[model samples]
Target chain A: MRKQKRGKRTAQEKANARKNITKAIWRHRELYLFMLPAIIVLLIFSYGPMYGLVMAFQDVKIGVPILQNKFVGLRHFNRFFSSMWFGVTVRNTVLISLLMHIVCWPVPLFLALLLHNCVNTKLKKTAQNFSYLPHLLSVVIVVNIVRLLCDGQSGLINILLREFGKDSISFFGDPKWVYPMFVLSGIWQNAGYDAIIYLGALSAVSEELEDAARIDGAGKLKCIWHIQIPCILPTIVILLILNMGQMFVIGADKMLLLQTDLNIARSEIIDTYVYKTGIGGSQYGFASAVGIFQNIINLGLVVLTNRIAKRLTDVSLF
Target chain B: MKRISGERAVNMVIDVLLVLVAIVSIYPIWYVLIASVSSPMEIAAGRVLFWPKGLNLAAYRKLFEMPQIWMGYKNSILYTSGAVLLDLAVMVPCGFAMAQRTLPGRKFLNTMFVITMYFSGGMIPKFLIVNAMGMLNSPLAFIIPGCVNVYNLILLRNYFESSIPESLLDAARVDGASFTRFFAMIALPLATPIIAIIALFSITTHWNAYLGAQLYLYDPKLFTLQQVINNILSRTSSMLREDISIEELTRITLETNLQKYAVVIVACIPLVIAYPFVQRYFVKGVMVGAVKG
Candidate 1:
């Protein structure tokens, strides 16, 4: 009798909770109507493709209905793991990603700090604008400029090299020059633009704290270290976490533009590999498997880094 | 006295470094411009350094003669304008709705959007989906898919939440103004600066994008400016292959080299002219978006 009475009360409570949810939803129907278009778009474009990830497991053949393909149960992944291309592409991806982080990471922050320190407002504004100009150029134009500058026979860099009694380096032809060229060109293109985010953060740092530090005999460097750096540290950590999420997904567009028969060995990362096999060769299943593998690693890296960031700095994307 | 002098010295070092930064950043764009107007022969001989050895508009003339360039320019303008309009239409209402504290499932919607930023089904799936939709080889493929960028959505949502005062909405509700009226009149008007920022962002993205046009578009008639420029670049670069004789390579270089620089300058002219006007707002936009609203 006691158990039956308790069950009746709990059932009544569950019904009341459900009714409350429906009531709340009904009250916000207008908001739901406002969001309907975006919801429809995302469902068709973003979420629909996510559902298509099943093609990674299927033996997707050309001209066949994607859903009708037979499920291969990880066969493509097995082949990718045992393949020689796997090692080469994975190694190049990691090395290039690390090189990018090491060489290209701190530049914008340094540029921001430099801009922040500038006493002349006009000079700072002009310099900032000039720095941002390269970022406006398309990848095609930037790559073309790179090719023009590094053209072995008639390029500017080689011209200067020959004038100084040095050998002209074929930047595109040599495999070893691939990483440096990629990293350096990236820094050149994005440093000034990327600095804007940090500049925004720097501007938000409290002037009162800096004034206090200065009055207490703290030097400019000391004030920056104590006040400004600490204020912007959260932004730095957040951007770093975001960077980790994107580590595996390098700019395949730029890489494709930079790639040649000579430097393919060092330049082909997973994204480019997927592009070549999936789009170029029409091996959809295998390429999809490779892409899925890359995304999984990307997700894992982001989650792990987020956890670490949350523990250490309390600044996490989540 | 020593401390004051030391601070001056540091400021001097920073100014010099900043000047170097500006020069490095601007020099390549400058180089491309001067190279475009310089004589091809002088450039080939490496005589064209700081100044043009022979001033010429021949490259620009050659670029204008290409039918593909004209078509690309037309298509890019059409697509960019269409994309900006569509993006603003979808993102503004969605962001405004998401900004409301009274909205049901707000947290769930926010998470759904942000999750897309971190994880995606990869490129193959996206291509397959677009193919299935029969949007391939069409301009819709470029303008529609990937329009609702999650980061930008969040940025706009954050902007709305922070900038729009709760009292205004309360007053409107008390006066019995409909949600639609409040959004159309109050929210949209207040969001003009951010709307411009989003429009600028969409413009650049659409203008610069070629990979999608490469994948989904096959007809040269459908190509964007960047795609056409890429076509020209790859075609010429392939001629530099070792199989080609030196005379032929040099001849090809002389013809195409200046044209390449000319194409870059032409493509960038629109952006360079508009950048200064928009530069001031974007910094504020980034700041508004940077804050955890």
Candidate 2:
């Protein structure tokens, strides 16, 4: 009787384990179905192109197939590293991105806070709508507007300067002003749009906490500083980390639009260099090499920042 | 007491400062509008200040006179409309699908999209794919590849998850409503904010896209407004710098800059007019997706 009971118990346990496995599979089936399209799209568009990164190591000719091209392993990399413009481009890209992060990143946060604090909802909404107007304008249009305003000979800025008996400043042509112009124009174009995210964050701040702070004799600024800023710190940190991760990618389109011969020294980042060399010069191999190099730096930065963020804040982009 | 009055004064000062900053931010665009309407000679001589020196509709007339500009405008409108439609078709359904927690592999799908947000195949690979697809010189080149933006997808997905209650979906299911019926009747209405956000984003992106057109479009007739304006500006600038006659150069430069701004005005005006209607949706949509999520 004991042997028979043991046999039945063992069989039941085996059957139960099999049933559990089946249930687990069933539970996850819908998720897999939902994810399939996105995965397929990513594989085709993103991962499929990853194979072309091999061209960076090749001495590619336009007519010849990519695979048929001669393998000149590290030759492009070596050339790029040794190039005179490499250090300058890297410095310009990093500095400009860093400066933009410092100046542009906070403007939205401040704007959002101010908007949040405003007593009149209508006024806040009006300000937001007006401010966000520039975000929709094309980069080309924005650049043209900038050029119109700052043109030395015919620009509105020079016209204004002349009224004060000052010489017209060649803002676009001068190298010193290029970075500032890029950063400022960037801030103007983006601040309102970015503020939407912060405004979203502010709305999430528990009203009860603000009430408590107020009852505790915390003034508006103190309540905001103590209650509000801390609540949004996670969002800010994540944004900061993400910004750092994208440090290698200065907005190439804007830079290309803004490029002038005089400012080329300061403006030629990796992306613009890739465009000028690869597309303009038809040196696809060299451009691919530069792109791959930038990608590597970007990947490293993202991973590093993500790791640091995870450790410090318990939040990571991943 | 006195401190409260002092704080009010400070607030007033701050408010004025904010208004000044806002004006500064918007001044360049204002300057462009003024310059576009002012006499070219006055613009060149730096005499035109805050307003138009002589309001001229000549630039607008000149732009309209060019058949190329009209063609460009038509192409841009078609491209933007088509792209937005395609983007919406894919994005709306995809977002709805993602909101189903019972759906299999949701986390994995989310991770896949997030990965794409940072890394792309870069331009050459994308070009190669488009070339391989035989989309080169075709409007499909502009439409198909960027059919859905991952950021928009995620945002829309978040909106669906937050705004649409599961009990409502359950009630629909109990009433024998098909998945399509449920999505169409219940989810779609609730998704208006995200739909509007996506529409605005997609329209602006498609309208502003110059690089895609530059890459795949070869036919002059197919050139978008931005491309046409770009060519006009460069050609006119080159003509002016060359040994062209001053009379001809002056005539061309004035016409080109004026028409360029006119093009800008035309491209911007429609969207700017449409923006206010959609702006309310944007804040709510953003809060739902980004903040609450």
Candidate 3:
């Protein structure tokens, strides 16, 4: 009688487990249907195309299937490494990126702090809207505006200088001014939009700490320095890490727009160089090789930064 | 009392400085608007400053006469609207689905989506895939590859999870409503602000997209505004100098510059008009997403 009862209990437990599995599947069926479209789209557009990266290692020819392309292991890579222009492109890319990062990253933080400190809501919103207007202007428009302002003969900038008894300067043509112009225009176009992130961070800071500081006889500046800055430090650090990770991926469109025969030496970063070679020279393999090189470097930077961030602050992009 | 008054004075000075900065920031836009309306001759001579000497719409008239400009406008509208709709169709459902924590394989799907935010199959490969799909010169090519933005999807997903209460979803489920009905009736209404934000972003991105159009479309008729403008600007010195007479050259230069500004104004105006309606939603959507993430 005891053995028969035990056997019946075991069968009941198996039945219950099967019911649970079925219920779980049924509960999640809607989610699976919803995710289907995005999954298929990403698989095709993103993951499926990853196979084409192998062409970077091949001698890719036009009109040939990527699979049929000659397998030339690391030949394009060697060519890229040996090219005379590689040093110039790498140096230009890193220097401009570093300069822009240094100058452009912190200005937004300062702007956010200033905006946060403003007592009047109307004034704050008006300032924000005005600042964000430039961000709405397309790169094409921004570049055209830059050209008009910096035109040699009839440019407003030269006209202003000439009125002050100064000679016309070829702002776009000069290599010395190229980096500065790129950095400055970048700051102009992006600072306001970037400040929104910091402003978000600033708003999250607790007000009780500021009040307590005031009660302790801390001045406004001291209170802000001690209370607010520390509160937002993690955000600043995370942004810094992310910024560093993208330090090699310079803006090719802006560089291409700004490139002239005269400024080619300074403005020809890796992106522009790859663009010139890929489209102009029709050296697809070589261009792909350079692109792959850039990706590897960027990947390394991101990993390194993530590790460092995690080690120091226990926060990481992952 | 004296120190307090001194602080107030300093604050007033800072306010004036900020106002000055704002003017400087907006000056280029003002300069272009004024210049576009000014007579090309006066603009070329550098005599017009701050405002148009004579308000004329000749450049605009000339631009309207160009068949290419109208074609560009049409292409841009088709591309932006189609892409935005596709983005929404794919992104919204996926975001809602991902928001369901009880979903099987949720962790795996989330990882897959997030992986894309960090890496991509570089541009050439993407171009090749689009070409292989026979999407070249087709409008589908422009919209399909960009159907989903992972970052936007994540934001939308997070918004759904936080804003749409679990109790509401559970109640809908208990009412014997299908998943589609539940999302359609309950969740989507709550997600309007985020939807608007993503829609605005999609429209702007697609409208300004020149690279994809340049790579895919060979037909001049299919060119978007940015692509046409780029061609005109890049080839202007050579094309005009070769074919046109010296007398007409000056006229062409002046005309082209004015037209360029006018094109800038025209291309951006629609998005600018749409912005105010979505601005309130954008601020809240961003704050929620950024703070939570």
Candidate 4:
């Protein structure tokens, strides 16, 4: 009798909650109207594509409505698993992303640390302003500049190589050189702009703490190690979690520009592969399957990283 | 005395490294500028390094003669302006609404927007949707589909939530002013800095857009500036799958290298001119965004 009475009361409470929500909506009708446009736009643009992921299971005909198309259970995914392109795309994507994380991850932090130590305000501002310029340039322009600099025949690097005793390297043509060029040029382009977040965190470090360390006869480097780093560790943790989530979301646009017949083996990431086969080649179902594969892994990484970050450091994206 | 000298040495080292970093950052853009004016023969011969030899405006003259380049500029400018306005219109009011404590389903709406930042249906499905919507090969492809950037939306939301005081809202309520009036007359004015940052971000994003234009646009007349530049660069190179004779390829490549630099400079001119003026505000904007709500 007691349990039944409690359940009846909770059900009544749930009904009241629903009633309150409706009342609140009516009260804030103007605000709801304000949010309507964005909600509608997102539904059409963002969620529409999400809903279209069902095409991964369908043998989508060009003119047929998506639902009317024959549904093939996991056939595209199976075909993708058996294909030669699958290994190539996945390996290239994972390796390039991993390489970037390993090589390019600490560069901005290092840059921020160096800049934080600098006392001259004018020099600091000039360095920062110039550094941010590359981030503003389009990927197309940046890749064009990279090609000019690394051009096998007339590129400045090759020119310098020949002037010395070394043989000229085919930076674009050789698959071996692709990863370094990609990772290093990426650092050059983004390190300054990326450093801005760390710089912001560093600026918030308490001057009293630094002064206290200095009075203890700690050197500047020691102060940085003991005082500044500890203070900004939370920011670093949050940014790292965010970066991990983007591990599979490598810039496919850059890869497309960098790709050539000669270097496609190294540069054909999942995104470029989708563009090439799906849009250009019109293999819609297969490409959608491949794209879904990437999305699941990216989303999975984000969740896993957030969990780990929260457990270990008590800092998470959520 | 020893400790003081050590400190001086460290400071000197830091300054020197910073100066070097600045130089390295500026060098590529500088190289492109000089090469654009330098004689093609000098560039090919690797004689043009720091200075332009036999400098001339031949490349610019050739570029200006092309009607497609002019059309690209017009199309891009039109698209970017439309995009800025659309983004502000869609995002600002929505952000303000999201920040309101009394809004129904605020948690659900926030979650829906944030989920997009991490996951999506990827490129192929998005293309199919856009095609189905009849936006392919249309200028609306540039302006509409991507106008609602989730990051900017959250930035605006957080800015409003943190910066606008609860007392202000209560006072407005006491005055019997409606939410719409308070938003327009008070909240909108206070949110100008963030709104400007969003506009600046929208401008740069639309202007630099390459892949979307490449994917959706097929007509030469509708090509963006980046697409035009891409066409010029890829026409004579190994980047694309187009076939041509080796001698013809070399000839075209040699002719366009100087023009390539010119194309890059022209493409970046608007951003280069505007970035300095807006740099401080955007820097502050990023810092604000770093502090999560």
DockQ, each predicted model:
0.65, 0.44, 0.52, 0.68
Clashing pairs in 3: none
lDDT, candidate 4, B1-293, per-residue tens = 78778888888988999999999999988988998998877887678889999887988999989888889899999999998999999999999999998787899999999888888877887888888889999999877889889999999998999999988998998999999999999999999989988998888889898898888999998999889888877666556446877777776677677788888888879878887798887688778778872
Position B94, candidate 3: lDDT: 95
By lDDT, the best candidate is: 4
lDDT of each: 0.85, 0.77, 0.79, 0.86
Q: What is residue B60's positional error in candidate 2, in angstroms?
A: 1.4
Q: After superposition, how far is residue B283 of candidate 1 from its true place, in Å?
A: 1.4
What is the TM-score (0 to 1) of candidate 3?
0.91
True contacts kept of each: 0.63, 0.30, 0.39, 0.69
Pick the DockQ winner. 4
Q: Give the interface RMSD of candidate 3.
A: 2.2
Quality of candidate 2 docking, DockQ: 0.44
Lowest-scoring 10 consecutive residues by lDDT in candidate 3 chain B? B232-241
Clashing pairs in 2: A30-B103, A30-B104, A31-B103, A31-B104, A31-B105, A32-B104, A32-B105
Candidate 3 chain A has its poorest 10 consecutive residues by lDDT at A1-10
Which CAPRI tier for candidate 1? medium
Alpha-carbon error at B51 in model 4, in Å?
1.9
What TM-score does the predicted chain A of each candidate obtain versus native chain A?
A: 0.89, 0.86, 0.87, 0.93
**Which runs in model 2 stand beyond 4 Å of their true positions?**
A1-39, A62-66, A119-125, A203-220, B44-47, B165-186, B240-255
DockQ of 1: 0.65
lDDT of 4 by residue, A1-318 (tens): 144555557777878767987898888999989988888888888888885578899988887987999999899999989999889999999999998886678889988998999988899889988887798888988998898889887777877787675899998888877788888889889999899999999999999989988888888888889998999888887887788888888867888898878987898888898888898889898888888988999889999998998899887777
Per-model TM values vs. the true structure = 0.94, 0.88, 0.91, 0.94
What's the best-to-worst order under TM-score? 4, 1, 3, 2
